[model samples]
Target: MESEVSRKVDFSIIRYAQCWEDPEILLEVLDIKEGDVCMSIASAGENTFAMLVKNPGKIIGIDLNPVQLRLVELKKAAFLALEYEEMLEFLGFSESRRRKEYYGKLKDYLLGETEKYWNENMALIEAGVINTGRFDNFFQIFRKKVLSLIHSQKRVAELLEKKNKEERYEFYNKKWNNLRWKILFRIFFSKFIVGKLGRDPRLFDYADNTSLSAVMSEKAKYAFTELDVSENPYIEYILTGKYTKNLPFAMRKENFQKIKSNLNRLELHNVSIEKYLETSEETIDKFNLSDIFEYISSEKYKELLEKIYEFSSNGAVLAYWNMMVPRSRPEELGNKIISLSETAKNLHAIDKTFFYSGFVVERIVK
Candidate 1:
């Protein structure tokens, strides 16, 4: 199979910020806080910027891909630098039947660089995100096309009206059960949503076909917070996409309401965790690896730790996670592994799905 995660970023912020696989619930497990310097992989720019909401001293978001970097730049541009409400309307925050108003809002805000990118990379903006200018009309057109093709036109229309989480859950579970599904999901959701959406490409990315199924199953069992909708409403909505039929909160402009004044604190980069550690002029108090090590091989896992150990001072706190795959880690790193009992217990107490496989690991620098 073509490796989808071959495109997976090293320290992407967007993936963590947008579709964290468990947004509203994973906060406790992440244990990240304000005034803390956080470093995360920038995937979609969502979590990279979202870190600002917590009032971090500095959020260093790093990625290698120019396209991903640009997208985060656009989110930062649209939110940090642009007019707030207009940015939201331009990026599909609320439901609107008035398509012209949606498209009109973006045309006004389109900047020079963003406009050039839009004109030149229209295909990317269609399949990807446009961070610089107004993307209202662009995405609206794209959304229409996707809905038309999915044969989900009315379902998409009805979904737009869902204003909050509860309504979204009800609509998906009982009303649009059929419409609430994706072929990808029917084939992969139960097993691979977390893996595909996870921080590591190795556990999900480099797996053998047989192992991929097991990875998917492990991922689904942990992330499937939707056992009974009444009991686990958020998980139900997440699994069904019944909630927030719109794009994720990170993509919405309203998130800036919480992050507006704190934008400058948002520092973005395009580098690996290793490269960032090697070259940065910063000391990180907290790190969210999001299972970064799951991507490394037996030999590389050692190198990953050597890099982490090089920067980590004794007793310095580190928070990341890994899959406990059979023989996943070589003995060298495993020998140094010290599971912070206090943090591990807290993760168990909190049923956040991303860290669901008891994926939270809090280790102090030895």
Candidate 2:
């Protein structure tokens, strides 16, 4: 049976244009070995493709939303058909005026449905597919509407400037954290506003009761002061409209050819994780269950974990994020799954995506 959140939230459109979870942290925790089969939730298909760079034998990308699966197919076609620079340009990393022309070139590589979808939505292709998601639009609004009210272009640029720990902290405290910034940020990021505009309200059903805006504001502070803004792509995309200094793992130039070479290993399925696990014959060595627990009930979370454990091989790793609702290996499964809490904590400290409150990693020992 589908969960209430799943039944309520609209899935016909893309929720995330880019996977907000940090692939760096995911790769670190999963530690994929050569020839290992992996499974990942296909949100925008970024992290799933990122894993291909590690030379995994195969990667199965499962998503309940068919539109998201189309995105994965579209991205796969882009990697197969376009060169590195062209891929970046077509995917909205670099500026390009010929995205429609590029789409023409990629048509031969896409599946029938994917091709039809892109053909129908040529405007999204022309506007750059990476910036077309609802989440990306939310960031665009924050960048253009809310951010402009708080800081000028010069101040925003200064915020992104390379700085040491002491300098960054001082800058944030003295110049960046003004009263206007705080008030406007809270107003824009409040649960009600975010639910209506940024994300589906059902996503927050299991979210913490504390002020969502306040928690997010503190997370932003950590990203601003503690992390290196110059290399953080999430912050860069949120502040500016596009990536400049660093790109996500799948989009990096060095990994492009490698991912392209291993494109044969990628597979996409439009099905729930539970459904996929029930039918999957392969023993998965790593699972990138991207923050899906945040939307489901606690009972369903535990039930899904057990299903995953049944399909996992010995020493298989499971990594997921907690945006609001805290979830991890249940006590009943403690003997079967070993918690790697210390490793998760260390990785969470350096996680590039700062919005998530926790990153949990566990291993099947049996």
Candidate 3:
């Protein structure tokens, strides 16, 4: 088992507050009505809660990590038990003795299993509001282990600051080709970065790329990106890091109220998007999959299409972001399901460099 310190938080949770998401995007992608049941992944949990603001039939949140599940529980508990001001304060607005008081009073609202996690994690809380997200402060390990090792910030700056992608790409290839670079990567991760806050150290691993334990450990390496990183800690961090500073609003702190209100109708799950499309018993009226497909290769997309068909109705809507690679067309899934909008032919669009550079697509069930 890798240490939680290295494995806990990263870039994903940080930018969770900013990227393009929800109300603006979900309605476009999911086409979900006010009372529709919604399902989603609870990466940072902002969307899960945000969708609730729409007053859906229900909101289900799923995640592979107990940590994330716990985060959801905390968010929901906060929504159910705390006042708006206290909720804001607990999540990201402030750090006060009021926090201890809130935890003490809200004990009744929390589930039995979640109690222990809360009790222990409570001691770690501090002044920053950002500490309230899914994987707070965990990136400190990432910085100490990997970012710190970049020998020269000057070269790092030139590579990242270069305006042109082609030039940047070439520079990255040259920098990584040097033997010293690879050695640092291996060494920083060798023992997993140690942490005083918890018992275990942290190691580098992409939780999204993990499979069932039946597979070999090395098999997980398949997710490593080939994109050029140019030794720029930021870009390399973006390629390998967790949170992106640029995510949708639903992922942010400002809209947590919307997420809380819509909680009942939104369901967050830990399972893969492909799994839902395959196994769902009925065709949901709307489906919004942020760009999970980008993480996978083209061959695996069939599972997605087939599964989506099972879960959709003629009027059912499909929405997703097409990451850097051209979005995979479900044309083979047949013409019945087709694009309804040209601006949305790519369904939807957010004008920003998100963790995923992609287009939002909205497809209808024929």
Better of 1 and 3 by TM-score: 1
User: Which segments of candidate 3 are over 4 A away from where they belong?
Assistant: 1-23, 95-97, 123-262, 267-270, 273-279, 322-326, 334-336, 345-355
Ranking by TM-score: 2, 1, 3
Top model number, lDDT: 2
Candidate 1 regions exceeding 4 Å error are 1-17, 21-26, 81-85, 93-116, 122-211, 214-255, 313-315, 321-337, 341-358
Worst 10 residues of 3 by lDDT: 214-223
- Score every model by TM-score: 0.62, 0.98, 0.58
Q: Higher lDDT: candidate 2 or 3?
A: 2
Q: Could you tell me the TM-score of candidate 1?
A: 0.62
Candidate 1's residue-wise lDDT over 1-366, tens digit each? 111234454432223223343333334544566677777666556656666667778777766644566566655656654465555543434333442343334555456655555456544333334222221222233234333444364654564442455566666556554432343334433334334443334355433344443444444433332222233323323333233434444544566677767777876665567767877666676565655555555556557656665666454445545444322234456445555656665554444443234454545446
**lDDT string, candidate 3, 1-366, tens digits:** 111222243422222321223345555456556767555656556556666656667655545446566666666677768777676556553334677767665688677666777776665333323444322343445445555566465654454442455554456556633555555444433323222221122222222332222121121121122222332222333333333233234545566667656555545454555544455664566665655555444555555565666666667665666533445566675575665556553423332222333454545455
Q: What TM-score does candidate 2 reach?
A: 0.98
Clash number for candidate 3:
47
Clashing pairs in 2: none
lDDT of 2 at 291: 89
RMSD of 2: 1.0
